[model samples]
Target chain A: MKTIAALCLWEERIAPRYDRSQKVLVVHLDHGKAVEASTIAVEHLDREELCKTLIAMKINTLICGGVVDPCRRTLEQAGVKIIDNVIGSPQAVLSRHLAGALSSGTVVD
Target chain B: MKRLQTPIPPELILDHLAVGVFTVDPDFLITSFNAQAEELTGFTRKEALGRRCYEIFRADMCFEGHCALRRAMDSKSSIVRERANILDKRNQERPVEISAAVLRDKTGAIIGGVETIQDDSNRAALEKQVKASYSFGDVIGKSPAMQTLFEALPVLSATDSTMLILGETGTGKGLTARAAHNASPRREGPFVKVNCAALPAPLLESELFGYRKGAFTDARSDKPGMFELAHGGTIFLDEIGEMDIGLQAKLLQVLEDKEFYPLGGVRPVKADARVIASTNRDLASMVREKRFRDDLYYRLQVAQLELPPLRERREDIPLLAARFLQEQGALEGHTARGLSSAALKLLMEYGFPGNVRELRNILEYAAALKPGGRIEPADMPRYLLRIDCPPAGAQRAAAAETAPQSDSTPDPTPERSETERKAVTDALHQAKGSRSETARLLGISRTTLWRKMKQLGLGW
Candidate 1:
């Protein structure tokens, strides 16, 4: 199925904390193949507003590290599936996700 | 004093301290993350070192430019005992008392800054418990609006005028009415509450005025109505707008003549009971639509008290939530101390359609769900997520309440943001760019005022 996923970002690695991430990498996938990608700077938005923005973008999944409950609960309630505590470069994480091997609390070598 | 030849390792001592201590370089990258800091931020020293400080301390102040460490570095001084919040690894918000100071090299060159964060969750919860004593009877509020209501309460309670309490459902109209009765001169007399909407027209009349013996098949003996029972006290007519027109006319008669006759008796009994009517409905609109009697509306309006909805008085949310957590948590035998900062923020952002009652219900549910610590966001009712964020006006108001001042130039956009921007710009000009004074004039926090100004492009 076609889907959109957002990975919370810090430089080249996945941010260790979802609420603190200043940027996000959004990727569009078609049948497990990446089709498009873009980066969003979110330093100006608060946690709640950031959640709203993700929902507004119709993101189907979220990949990140530790997520505070408020944002996690809110995003999940909005139907955005969260893959939390996943650590790695955004590209490596996306590759694992596409391979159906990524799981919660995955740590990259 | 003589200095010891061998000195204790400062890093070891810092690691042993109860408070979390971390240091960041001039570029704001972490240089040292002590043991307590590791536990609090949920990051190992290996992972935390070399990362940006803001990434570890995802505090509201950090995003809003109220960072204590930043302020300390800029001022070349120490910031002692300031309260702030940071999100832990699991995204739970932890309240902390922070102190920050610039770190200098042995050569006296400014190097970086060190911050110490002491968890204050326990102390904060304890402080809230102490505030529970400030509540006026069962009703609790410290907002100016509530204070005004409190100031007017004694005078209203002293008089016998028919009082109309107006508010949205669950905004404590019932409680306010009860407080009025308890505070009145007729405290010894019974305080009767009648739900006008709960009964049919025929039964409602009999329930209000009561019936004499043999009046109906079920009427075995003469019975006193609520008004009669509350002879020298008060009768709280809840949802008064729902009363039938015929019953309303009879009520109007009682208000006018101070007497009501039994269902089948010729003799009229004096009804000295003070009447306090309450409704969530707009009685004025009801009168205009011929759904409610104008005369009855005016009678109840003689002494009106409109309770502000919980959203309008956001300042009271923390106190009310804390109070409910204590009262309900104790009843449930739960160990929940208080709500986390994120949970409290959620409560504040939600527009409580059900008002204070909804807040209490939320807390009761949270108290039951939370294990043995501060109530975190996950502990709150899941349905709270379904509630939409409050209107933009409210959001703007809230933003203004948290913002700090800035010296940046304005960057106006052609977007439809004139009203709010102009207000902030004018206020800032009047206050001579003093953020605190401008915030005071706008009835918001300097942080909030700064945020609004930033959002509206009033301040860069």
Candidate 2:
């Protein structure tokens, strides 16, 4: 089955605060090849709603910068894998994640 | 007689004052420390000098983004009498009132900052005495109803039984749920909360129990729901009465079997989450009306807690009002001291239909409308003015009717403002018309004393 990942994007790099991120980038992969991508505008929703949005999108993985305990726990409990505290451009993180080089709590500035 | 002509040092002058005074450079490094500052902070001048002010005084706001000296320097203005707490050398918390101003060198260039600190233990104790014991996490209430709730929280938080909370809108249903999660053994786990009424049935269903990649166009990959995410923790369902009838059956299945199937998944996911549900509507009535399922309602009611509305707990009004005022003042950089007696009376008399949330909004409005100093009755929102509180004229008429027969004698019960004005005038007279001296005696800021004198039409 193909995997989908969502990255909390600020401008070019990941957002500093996961709960207050306004933009989310969802990427779809088939056999490790990029198939489709979408940008979701999530400024209207709060932290809880943001989690629900990721779940609804069937996003199995989430990549972002700093995430607080409550938000990280909620995402983890939902069975979605999170690689947080990553500090890099969305493209770099996505590439790293695809290569399986990205690990949770690694700061890839 | 030959008089000894010796000039008193500047440090000696500052040391003789009752209040603690200190100076800090633009970088927040301690520059000069008076004797009183040394005594209050338990740090000598030798130890305090050349060190960061926070390293010595260790005020709560020093590293909390509310440093008075930093604010003064940034704004190039004076912060008149803001209350803060500091930790001394022994790590004892000492409440203090801080006033700071930007210091300028020759040629009008900003140099450093000067701050004065006064011990506020007596004042803080009195204010705490007024509020009594009304604190639990973020929940604030002093009424018997809230007390009962507080007493039951510890025991309820220890168990994972399905618990139902009944309360009106804005009555702190969510706060209580969070408090339970924070106090529970599973506090390390996630607390997932969903407002059942916030989303439509389709979206809510997907949100609660996720779907497979091909279940829908948006579902590009398998996803998990709030229940799965709340494993070993808690899931708060707010406005549970608004949940869809069909969804309620599915929820009951999860509660019974401790497992639930995703929308398109063939396998059932284990549900390790504890359920905490809340509703504003009467579930019994909803069950009778066929809007709510009887079985689901019974399952949720295994442990029930009914939160009392703010109107029912009137005794907590003053405390809540004061707390809100202080919070607003701190956030907005205003000096909101307190409320006028008339304003407090108005707040007490008005029945808050929207409960504590409404009270918070009301105070926010009053804080903006108030020109300066304490909030007055006139500062309240116009909507609150429409509420049928007893008018001042009615009180005067009632007083007149109840008074014993007298030949045009003066009324004995004076208004609070009048008494305050008389006290200010007397203090000013005793201080020989020095506003600063009067403020020190009255335990207020010189700015406040000046404002009072001007408002009261005192010639001085």
Candidate 3:
């Protein structure tokens, strides 16, 4: 099962309206696979919108820098898992997610 | 050069003086003693005149050591305002302030010393009483842990830092918090407490942060919250882990900024009260599981104090039991008696999962049940007696009662314990084997459940 999907804000900033253009990222995980989707940019998105996007994609896992209650609740309602709040490259978070050793909701800063 | 002078009566002059005056020779012998001196020493001049001052007075001071009269005579100068102890004829030692001056003749040669004494024993007694009254009494515990706790109390009492007291239900966490408050600089201020788990989220919030008029259905008038009431004092948050996650965030914000808004009010009110939070739950585990907030956990853990469980400190059981008996007996208007050695032994041997609280409840039950007499092992609860017996009989009885009656054929099982074992194993696997949570779900005390788990060798 793809248990987690990464949302990269750095990529969205360089590519204008990147979220609207490509709403989902499908990645293979160790135990499974995951689909990540969001209507708003990862950096500018509030917790609720982020949660809605994750729910829409049927994704239960996420990796992001900062999150608020709306995003937390939406993800929780969708049974989506959140990994450590990653600050660096999104690829590192994806790697940890594949290893199944990643601790969720941990502030990585 | 003949001048005839009128003689003045020394007795008349001495009798009218207020100060206790006496004359001592170079050998420290009492010579001329005035009426006041005789009254002060509880001796007549006739009895004191020829005796040594030390022998007559028997003061704590000796003539062989530092005597003000001797120093005054030796130096041929006034030795004024010296403090010492003096013994009266009745053998009562009194603190006396003495002023000794060297008596000189017309040629300026030192003759004897004249000393004045004033009793100061009353002042000394008053000082002693003040010192004795400041000690915190009746709070008994001499163990090293308690001693260290008492020693650290002053430091805790001196500050306004948030304190977290972690202990089982009956370890007197509430009492400790009160003690800390009473010992602190805010002793005169209010000590308010809120049971976080007892109230619903909305009510708990309104109770904590106050509410404006017409804020809710029953909130007809503006009422001050515990925070407002506890201004310049302390607010104890009990069972803090049970507080709702949403309120936890608000509480965290208030702790960080020392300001909170009322339920409906727009203006922020500054909170000056110190916070003391307590819980028996494994909060770190809760945080790890995301049941509790991490930021709130760190904020409340400024100065953490963990109280050891009653079973861990069984030495205090007897004392606590005795105190409880006395308290309960006093309240009930009955004579408090000691517990039988066997009963006490039973209590000490039993592992109390509820901690001090459980012990107290047991004692209260025993006290209530014992018909105006001493408590014995038989007087204890039935569950206590069952601890020694294995669960095989109960398990068989339960299985026999619950088994299907109209089964076509009875397949012989090894034993009911085997079935119970299998059921427990399945439950553990289904619950992801979280022992603490399993204990909660199984409707058994953690200690009892843990014992069962250990017996079944249910490893994490």
Q: Return the clash pairs for model 1, or none.
A: A68-B91, B400-B448, B400-B449, B401-B448, B402-B447, B402-B448, B403-B446, B403-B447, B403-B448, B404-B447
The residue-by-residue lDDT of candidate 3 on B13-118, one tens digit each, is 8777977888887776688888877777767787678665654444444422677787788777887777777656543556877888888789987778888877
Which candidate number would show the highest TM-score if scored against the true structure?
2
| Model 1 regions more than 4 Å off | A1-109, B1-134, B334-336, B391-460
lDDT of 3 at B74: 79
TM-score of chain B of each: 0.57, 0.60, 0.56
Per-residue alpha-carbon lDDT of candidate 2 for residues B157-248, written as tens digits (9 for 90 to 100): 89989989997666788898998888888899999999897789988998999898898777899988999899999999998988999999
Task: Evaluate candidate 3 and give its CAPRI docking class based on DockQ.
Answer: incorrect
lDDT of each: 0.79, 0.78, 0.66
Q: Compare the candidates by DockQ and give the number of the best one.
A: 1
Backbone-clash count (model 2): 2
lDDT string, candidate 1, B1-460, tens digits: 9999989999999899998999999888889989999888777888778777776666667756688888989999999999987877666778888999999999978799999988899998898765643454577798888888887877898898999998766678888888888888988898899988778999989889988998888999998888888888899998897798989999999999999898988899999999999987778977988888999999889999988878789899998887787777666666559888999989888766456776786676667677457888887654465434464454334332232222342433333255445555665665688887665544444545656676665653
